[model samples]
Target chain A: MKKYLSIIVVSLFVLSSGIAFAYDGSLIDDTSYTGTITKIDRGARVIELTTKFEKTPKTWKLNMQDECQIQVMTTKDPSERGAFKKFAELKEGTLVNVYGWPKDGKWLARKISILNPDDYMVKRLEADAKAGVFFGHEP
Target chain B: MNKKGFLALILAVLFLAGTAEARKTEITPADQRDWQVIAPQDSDTPLRDYAMLYEAGGHDGNIGVIGIPSMKPYRYIKMGVDMHNFPFSGSNAGNNNGTPDGKYLWVSDKGADAVIELNLQTGFAERILANPKPFGIHHSAAMSPNGKYIFLTGELSGKMAKMRVADGATTVIDVPPAPSAPDYPDASKDGKYVFSGNYYHSAVMVFSQDPFKFIKEIPVGKNPHGTNFLPTNRWAVVCDKLSATQSVIDVRQLKVHRVIPVGAGPLHNQPDNFGKYNYISSFVSDSTCKVDLGRMQMVDEFPIHYRVGHNSIAPDNHYYVSQNKFSTGLFNPTGIVFAINFEEQDIDELSPTYGKTVKIVPINGEPHEGRQIFSTTIQRWNTGTGGDLFAKGYELGDVKVNFDEKVPGKGLTKRPSLEPIHLAAAKRYFIPRDDGKPGVTQEGDVTVVRVKAFSYGYIPRFIHVKKGAKVRIILTNIDKAAGLTKNPDVTMGFLPAGYYGQKTRLDGVRGMSAVGEFVADMAGEFEFYCQQFCGPLHLEMRGTFFVDPPGGTASLSVGDYDEISKLEYQVSDPSEREFITGGNRLLNTLKEGNEPAL
Candidate 1:
């Protein structure tokens, strides 16, 4: 009975690990934002985005780490997991929620999730309000 | 008037008149005439040497030939036009470097999947090689050192094509695998191997030219864009755009020799005439740096305008031109968009004006790539050097689409109709769905819409999708079948106002289709339109992309024309004083001949 229990536990751990790294892998304890990609330097693998979190539209240059996890949402549900994609597939004008941390005085992207068009309106407005685009909505 | 002696004058007046007539007839010598005074070249204004700048046309689909020093337009080579055997546009230039002999130039027209050969001596297209499908979207046309073959990169196909120049026979080679976008391809100086920069990965892929097989991948910085082989034949430099560095590869050993740090976005690499110094153009950093090949270290850096896309060193090593990608706020705002400029800097160390910007030449379109050739190589119209294009039996007007063995049936005048296929795919959108929303249907998980693009407009002008639904747009260009626009290369993009990005843009050739899928995250109306300039009504080639709120549908009814008329009148409000006097008050005062108040 003891051996069987240990085997079951090991199986559970392996399955979870597989799921975690299935669509690339994300860094632990990183801040995330949903923004529109404004510019891209394909050679540098860096992107300039206007995040919805600021009071004004602030351009943020985020460099993708070599091991950064990238996924694209394939379903209408924002929470649904999507397929893995290469860094070259990411194009300008894409709406994405990026998880990143500050490293070496630069924004290092850990994971990038291309957002679904269905959720764009709410997120865009939320970003607009945070950017203080509306009167009396200053933050 | 010399009625000199008014009375004695009857005879004297006649003599005076005759003398005046003679004086008027007497002319100055032709050589002594004082024409428009142009400053002559002196010690301070030494006459510069001559060179020809061949710039790849970004949107205009023409190669601009400009004369150096004079800063004058020489002529333009039209690509993928009626002038060429293969008629198309939206030319995405690969490399502007002429053949080894400098007799021909190879450029890629991505829209047509054809690489055009331009005769440098004749200024006319010599041939068009339609690289077969699955080897499409050719980006670079790097000619071999022997000038016998041209290597090309298919960005979307993830493949590299090697075409024999003599017979135009093309052989497709797989790059690596999916996720590998081979961007710039170049042949080794010794012509033994070919190298391609993998845009997706941080490595350069090498292939043996003789056997045309993959050799190995050399690890480098991320997003290696351009690979330039030095004249030394022992070393090659790869611009790692994303890594902000350049990697030097030892061609003899086929390994990375050094990775030198550079400014952000090192895009293109150009070696000076002697191959001692390499010029790296940092696009995002808006600067260009010179690296000493011996030490593999940057020696000097010069600041340039915003976003230099491509740079070229003069053949004589006297000047450097940085082709800035953007001109926003750099020049006078004339309400016109796409105004670009390139800066020319003196690089000669012995010159007193070295390191100074010699000229800032404004161009109409973007300079995708540029090559500087010594003036002695090609004869110019100013020199009346060689056989003119007209003398070679080239027509000024559009030639009839001709079929050739090199590219069979590629220049077809009529394209097959895709209407039946489009209509069938669009049927699902018109039928009421389970949710009672017409023109929107959820298939399993995502909502799909089929759209057809023609000249000046898109079918189903309004595309409505529910908020929170994933939307996939499949766009097809029917311009060739519709025969509406003369130029049929149309790209439709789902772009909202002030939004930047070409990710959603679907580029298509006539009778070709493209697909773009994304989540419908935003609610409210966006716009979809032809991104490429097609004709006079290009701006009108737009439609509404409506994202309705969840469980709510947008009102698509125009109701009546009277309602729009009333709305327009209500907004006009002619009673406002500003409406009647809309001209600038200062301009009005000036027109009345009054000094305007400060």
Candidate 2:
């Protein structure tokens, strides 16, 4: 399998500002997104999942950017989640679920669920991302 | 090498197309304000095209209404500045103070040793000879409540320049130079007493034109930088930068009331939300501490950013500090405004926990003044919390810092103490943009990629996504000035905001670009933030992303001016936002080969 990546540049401009609150119609309603995680970046506290929505399973990302905001979930022990500070720890095959929308451009996750990372299927994808090959983890 | 090189080249193209940036723009009478999150073209300014204050969810799963939170949250218009065009000079801008009418911006240029009057309405820039002979005009240009006299500090020249505003005349009052005089040559409200900080002389010089003579000098700490008079002319406050202490001097008596050890490097400040408690900024630790004027003791402190030499308190308690010299947070306007809450924690006087401590919280509000990337830190601090901090309902922080500074002085004067605000703020805010919708999209192909650049402190911002073919994003915060992050191994650049609680770690001192690349595995919106205690709005530092449909959305043309202008990049009302921000030569050049040229 082949893997590819894209890079985007960023910049800024100066303007005489006058109440610059642009509109907010693009964001998907928080309740609209539903999916299950296929991976988690523990150190980054970000989880990727193929969610099973009421209509369809959507793929997305979830995170508690600040660790203090990361509530200790009963499903994942705080120690095991220790990797929340190091993204490499989340591994490719972690089974997780998420609910979020397209904020900015990518998925801006709002809710997430951590399925048992021990799930055998998850380990498979983990092996794939590491092997730098195609990891069929999509739901 | 041949096979891998080919694939690598292609991947590089996709990766190159996915970088995110912050651009703060406005709309024309053409209406509409949908924020468009576009990747910054390779240009000089950064953070102006992306969104800011991107919290992943702190409000019980509700991040600070970051750019229209109700929808898919892709395009959010933010507030920031063009760092490349910043009114830069080696000297700090004394750009503080607006006219009593609040219509004009007073650009205090410390380096030029002059005041530049910026007519917001006309966009005209003019210089005013505010003072004379100060090599480093630190700041402290006090406008009379009546706008009659403008009292300013001559930082290096070691003098105070007092100007009579009523007649457009500047009279350089050769006040007796303190050991380190005129850190900020500001005056007391009553107009009867003029106070200036003697940073080098370590003293407070006091005088008023009524007598035209140096009345008294109060001895203070190592290098008192800022001086402000409590609304009541009876007292004056001084902030010592080097030693991180504040001194209170009896205005009439011309005597030192009490010198208290506040935060690390107390530089600029404001009053509490209610204007009763004075909140001062601690530069080195990047913390803002508060003082209960009544009790006269250092109560608490909150973390902000480093080398925050300038600050302002809104008419409300929310305070702001300019991210000076530091590139990452350099040109951010809303990024500078820090909401603060200060309260007296009861403690037994002698015990470690006995003395009362102050608390500071940053806030998010509409940048009331035109988004000039710079808000004054001299807002009047009130002691009362006014209301719940940060969230909209509460009273907004009352501190407003104005820059257009230049004043004339009489023949003689003395100096005063230096210290800035009270404490407890929401976090940090960098740039702002409208939360617009995703651009034209193809139906099927989708891949996710993350770009993790620059990692510092805790709270490393990561972008995660389903790993197929879309351009997913995962960003790393290398800005050490982000005050919200914590790490014992990193030495952060916030002392005035008091980041000392998190000892200086080896990783704390890093340039703006930290890790540089971490791809998202999924195709979705990604979130990022500063993982260390950078400065005032550290927590507010955030950027969002979008993973293109796997095949990548092909555009009609890259350099079509009309298409680029009308394509609705990241703003809903492209015309309106463009009218205010379109003159950007940099924006045009960066997008020259990519987006249509405006």
What shift in Å separates residue A30 of candidate 2 from its native position after superposition? Answer: 53
In order of listing, the candidates' clash counts read 20, 269
Off by over 4 Å in 1: A1-139, B1-49, B81-102, B334-336, B380-598
Ten-residue region with minimum lDDT total, candidate 2 chain B: B496-505
Tens digit per residue, CA lDDT, model 2, B1-598: 6999999998987776554212224343323332231332111123221111121111111112111101112221211110000111111101222212222334343222334333221223322332222122323355543344455655433555554442234444445643344656555543356677765567878766443347777787777766766542435678876676788777656888778888776766554211235667675675557676645687666555333434443221222333221322323333222222122221212223322222222323211111111112112225554221212211112212233333222111211111101111112222222122222222355332222223222332332233333331212224333333232222222111011101111112332211112222323332222333344333233433333335443121211223222322222233323212111112212111121100
Candidate 2 error regions (>4 Å): A1-139, B1-99, B130-140, B177-180, B273-275, B305-307, B318-598
- Candidate 2 Cα deviation (angstroms), residue A100: 52
Error of 1 at B562 (Å): 52
In candidate 1, how many Å is residue B341 off?
Answer: 1.4
TM, every model: 0.49, 0.35
Which digits, one per residue and each the tens of the lDDT, describe model 1 over residues B144-193? 54345667776655677766654455667778867566767777644467
State how far residue B576 of model 1 sits from its true place (Å).
61
